[model samples]
Target: MRIALGLSYSGSSYEGWQSQLSGNTVQDQLEKALGKFANLPIRTLCAGRTDAGVHALMQVVHFDTDLQRELPSWVRGTNAFLPRDIAVQWAREVPAQFHCRGSAISRRYAYVLLESPVRPSAETGRVGWVYRPLDGAAMREAATHLIGEHDFSSFRAAQCQAKTPVKTISRIDLSQRAGTGSSYWRFEFEANAFLHHMIRNIMGCLVAIGQGQQQPGWLAEVRDARRRDAAAPTFSPDGLYFLGPVYEDLYGLPTRTAAYDWLP
Candidate 1:
């Protein structure tokens, strides 16, 4: 039987989402825990791979099991065996043909910015700290140009191993959250797919525009340029969150104009 499992993990200790040769990985830990439960070799295919230090609020993964274990027990059992940082939130029987990664119609990633002179206590895992005053309005304007299908080579990481650089950024919603001292900003983006480090790279360019280092109109020209050098530096991964994967069948998922938030 095939099962779809909802997982959430803190990527602090792991090398990345994939298994590694020399370091701890989220996949390695998951496989070991699942193998223990199955008493047989087990593996999972995740909806997405987050880099080290990244966090996923809701990541879907699927695995096949010949042992017809109860679906609810898989969630309870997996959580019991897994570390606190890695958890199995929910599990259900899925069609054998339902693939967690390939079947995903869209992916959403949110990058947070804590624009403040002083560090914020409430935003350790949630927001990236920036000491400089960021122009929130400018950032919003700059991000508008990125909301379309384009060859995103200008913002892709040089180390990115994807076969192609083209991606359709369906939406890029930039806004500020209400706060007292530190201004909290969010960049919520939805795309059919994303290349490695794509969201952070776009955040970097947006930051540059906010800081007046780059002009707002440069984003469109950079897309047209299709050169990696055309974009600014990559933003820190600490402020980014893989909010959730958008399956076509889930109606609760936010649409283009919906206010984005962390999802389970």
Candidate 2:
């Protein structure tokens, strides 16, 4: 039987999602717990891999097991052996055709940034920090150029293994919310797929435009350049969150978790 899992994790203590020889990655830990729970070797394939220090609000992964266990047992049993920062949220019996990665139609990510002069202390590793005020309108204008199908070479990482730089960014939305202490900004992205460090790289450019260092048109110029040097430095991954993949309705997976509603 094939099972699909919905999970959320805090990447603060992990070495990203993929299992590594170091045995510190989210995948390695998850697989270990799952193997112990199932009393058999189990391998999982995820919808997407997140970088170090990046959280996931909803991560979908699939694995096959001959051992029969109730959906609730999969969630509770696996989580019992998992770490505090990583967890299995829900489990479902998926059809054999279901693939956590290939079945995904699109992926979404969100970055939560704290625009404050005082650097983050208690929220360290949980939120991205910016000392200066940002021009939201300018950032939005710069973001417009990034939408649609295009070669995102400038924003992709050097180590990215993607075959092509071309990707379709369907939507890029920026919303700001004021607070009693510090203001927050949420940058949401929906795309067919994202290259390694793509969003973080784009965040660097958007931040530059918001800080009035670059014109809104600069993003378009960088996109045309198709060179890594044309873009801003890759931003911090602390605030980045994998909102997870969007699968077809046939899957019937929950679109979000409670963590989604708690974000600013």
Candidate 3:
């Protein structure tokens, strides 16, 4: 039988989503816990892979197993062996044709940023920090240039293994809320797929425009350059969160968890 699970984790303590020889990644921890629960080794494929220090409000994965068990057992049992920062939120038996990654229509992500003269303390690892006040309108204008299908090589990482540099960005929404003595900015993105470090690289550019270092139209120049060095440096991964993938309704999989309500 094929089983799918919705997962959420604080990725600060993990190496990333993929399993590694160090066995310190979220995938390694999850598979280890799953192996313990099933009394046999279990392998999983994820909808998307998050880098270290990032977080996931909803991450989807699927695995095959011959052992028959109730859905709740899979959730409660697997989580029993998982660490406190990581969890199995929900589970469902899926069709053999359902692939966690390939079946995804689009993926969503959010980057939480804190703007303040003082560095973050309580929310240190949960938000990106900028000491200078940002020009929201400038960033919004800069973001508009990225709103369609285009070559995103300028924002992609050098080590990215994506077959193509072109990706369709369906949406980019920016919102802000006042915090104690500071303001919190949230940038949400939905795309068919993302290249490695794509969002972080974009964040760096947006921040440059917001800080008056570049005009909004500069973004188009960077995009046209199609060179990674033409864009701003990659921003911190601390603020990045994988909001999960958009799947067809036929799959009957949950796209979110309670953790979504907690994000800024």
- Candidate 3 positional error at 174, Å: 0.3
Candidate 1 overall lDDT versus native: 0.79
| Number of the top-ranking candidate, with lDDT as the measure | 3
Error of 1 at 152 (Å): 0.2
User: Candidate 2, residues 116-191: lDDT per residue as tens digits?
Assistant: 8899898899889998889999999999999999999999999999999999999999999987666899999999
Give the 10-residue window scoring lowest on summed lDDT in candidate 2: 175-184
Compared with the true structure, all predictions reach lDDT values of: 0.79, 0.94, 0.96
TM-scores for every predicted model: 0.91, 0.98, 0.99
Pairs that collide, model 2: none
TM-score, predicted candidate 1 vs. hidden true structure: 0.91
Span of ten consecutive residues with least summed lDDT in model 1? 251-260
Task: Please give the distance, in angstroms, between residue 38's alpha carbon in candidate 2 and its true position after superposition.
Answer: 0.7
TM-score of 3: 0.99
Q: Write the per-residue lDDT of candidate 1 for residues 125-213, one digit (tens) a residue.
A: 65777777788788778888878888999888878888889888899887787567767887888999898889888888888888888
